[model samples]
Target: MKLPVLVLCLVATAAAAPLALAQTPIDPLDARDVRRLDKMEQVVRELRAIVFQGRDIGKPVVVQPAETDYQLQEVSRRLADLEQTITRMTGDLENANRQAELAKRDAEALRTENRSLSDRIASLESRALAETVAPPGGLGGASSGLSANDLFSEARQALTSGDYAAAESGFREYVDAYGDSSKAAEARYWLGKALTARGAHADAAGSYIAAIRGWPSTSWAPDAVVELSRSLIALKKPADACQTLAEFAKRYPKASTTVKTRAAQARNQAKCAA
Candidate 1:
């Protein structure tokens, strides 16, 4: 009876083991999860040791949470994204700076080109003015057997007679032949008047500038400056016109009433400030 009872008990135990395994099935864990569980178990063991060891041992134990590691990884990823964004912004800023520098260089180049063009135009006008007044046979033929005074007098008479063409020709000839003469400045002034009458304001300005180079105290000096300002105004150079007028009082304080009146008129036309 005892042997049969033992056998029945062993069979009952075997049947209960299968039923328990079937009722509570074990979920399969991957390698990563198994490692995480191992690490957590190790941390728990360390914490248990620290708690059991008592405060008098003075040993410190650090426990890190699995969630804290995930948070650190997320923060690291965000930091990497921010670094990439900053690098892109830095590249954009550098590109903008390069474009600005290029634009500055372009503007400077344009200004230089404009100045060169202006100089070329002025030179061409001067050459044209010389060609217009110079005779085909040159100064030798037109000014032949004529004294400097005679040529100067003829040019003045031609101007008075409203013969601008003849006056311009005669004056240009006189200037070329007797540039060192005392009447050269006067000739330049008359040449400017002829050019102004011909609507060559740019050329007229040039001649006026030459005439007043020394700021001579001659009777015509004040008038020449006034005429220069007028020519500058016609050439659409109000700033230069205003500057010329500003110097009038200093250069010709004792100028005649007529010349002063003309200077004032030029200033008004140029819209110069007081």
Candidate 2:
């Protein structure tokens, strides 16, 4: 009897377990929970699609946020601006370098021209000196035997004969030997004329300056001043030439018509003010 009772109890417990489970209340999901589940489902679908696409294409998967495209665009714009700035700076630097090179070349050209001019002047001076020594037993070689008056006469004769080299040597000797003599100024004037004929304008200017010292009262004084002005003009010193001419009218009021005419010509050459 106990065995039948135990079998019936076991069957009743088994049927009541199902009834208890059927009576339990299940809580439905809220709106927030439903939205969260939907978002998770969409993300899972996208990830699966990306994985499948990457496997098919044999390329790596790259998942970017929504703002990443905008950030990349901003970085690209900044890089473009930087590239433009670098291009402008490079152009400016190249222009500066080109200008500096041009300036350096110009300076070198000017230096070369100046050196050539100096060499030409020195060659002319050497030629003049060589000519002075060329004549056999000429004024310079035989000058020791001649008296001062003889030397002056020979130099004047050489000048009149257009023998400029002998004249220069003789006159140079006369001035050196008799600088304190009465004809010293005249000798210097003649020396300046010979130097001028040889295109030695710088040396001629010095000789003329020495000849016109103290503004002597001789007849040649006005002519010396005019010749000095001419030499100054040759030296590209127009201002100094004009200044020398200005003193001519005041210093030599009794200047000859020939000298006055020469002075007028020099004034025109120098473009002196009236």
Candidate 3:
């Protein structure tokens, strides 16, 4: 009778074992989420099956053995961790999408801005080029066909070919003949460059200063300012050089590389000893 009662108790325990090892359901809408949960569910089912099998192998066994309980708890804890990981991944994907959208918008805005700037620059260049070829509306109208560009090209070619004398002569002629020309400012700037190349620092400083003062809005003004500062330093007038360099940096902060480099050199030379 005692053996039969013990067997009955074991049978009842075995029957209730499967009920104790139940799986938690996961509701996922999207295909990606469905696949992810399917894999997780498979793992959970495997854990449940193993724990239930262990209970059947032992008489009057608990739903999960002590050793099996530890593993099941670990699996549950891992599932919770995976859920948190998925949440974080979803957040990161959302942020990346937002960043990509912002980048696309910013790129479009930059392209529009660049196109506008190019149009403005082209207009200025066209005006400058036209002014270069056109003669002054004065007594010099008869000789209007003679363009400053021709003279400048000749001067530049001569200078580059090491003909300092001819370059100097040509530059002087351009400045005198085209006093009111758009290229006048550039002509004066190049005159200073030519004089400087010929080791005439005093004349170069004068020419550069005149060029910048006469046409502050011209494209050559910034270059003239840089050249003047360098010439002032060479003339041993560091105080004046400092003033010129500081002015150049302040006025043309976004100037050409050559201008910026010269301005830096002038600042170094101008600053006094400690």
For each predicted model, how many residue pairs clash, with residues at least 3 apart or on different chains? 0, 0, 0
lDDT of each: 0.77, 0.79, 0.68
Model 3: per-residue Cα lDDT over 1-274, one tens digit each: 0224544455555556557545545454798888986776565565555555656665433333358788899999999999999999999999999999999999999788656644543443344334333223321212545566777788778788888767777777777777788777777688778888988887777667657753376666787877777887788978666656656766777788876776777678778332
**What's the ranking of the predictions by lDDT, best on top?**
2, 1, 3
Q: Rank the candidates by TM-score, best first.
A: 1, 2, 3
Off by over 4 Å in 3: 1-147, 272-274
Give the distance in Å from residue 69's predicted Cα in candidate 1 to where it truly belongs: 76
Model 2, residue pairs in steric clash: none
Taking every candidate in turn, the Cα RMSD to the unseen true structure, in Å, is 12.9, 20.1, 15.2
- What local lDDT does model 1 show for residue 116? 67
Q: Which stretches of candidate 2 lie over 4 Å from their true place?
A: 1-138, 141-143
Candidate 2 — worst ten consecutive residues by lDDT sum? 128-137
Q: Candidate 1, clashing residue pairs?
A: none
- In terms of lDDT, the poorest run of 10 residues in model 1 is 134-143
Can you give the lDDT of residue 205 in candidate 2? 73
For 113-205, candidate 2 gives per-residue lDDT tens digits of: 656644543454454344442224358523467788899999999998999988988888887778899999999899889889988887777
TM-score comparison, 2 vs 3, better candidate: 2
Per-model TM-score versus the true fold: 0.51, 0.50, 0.45
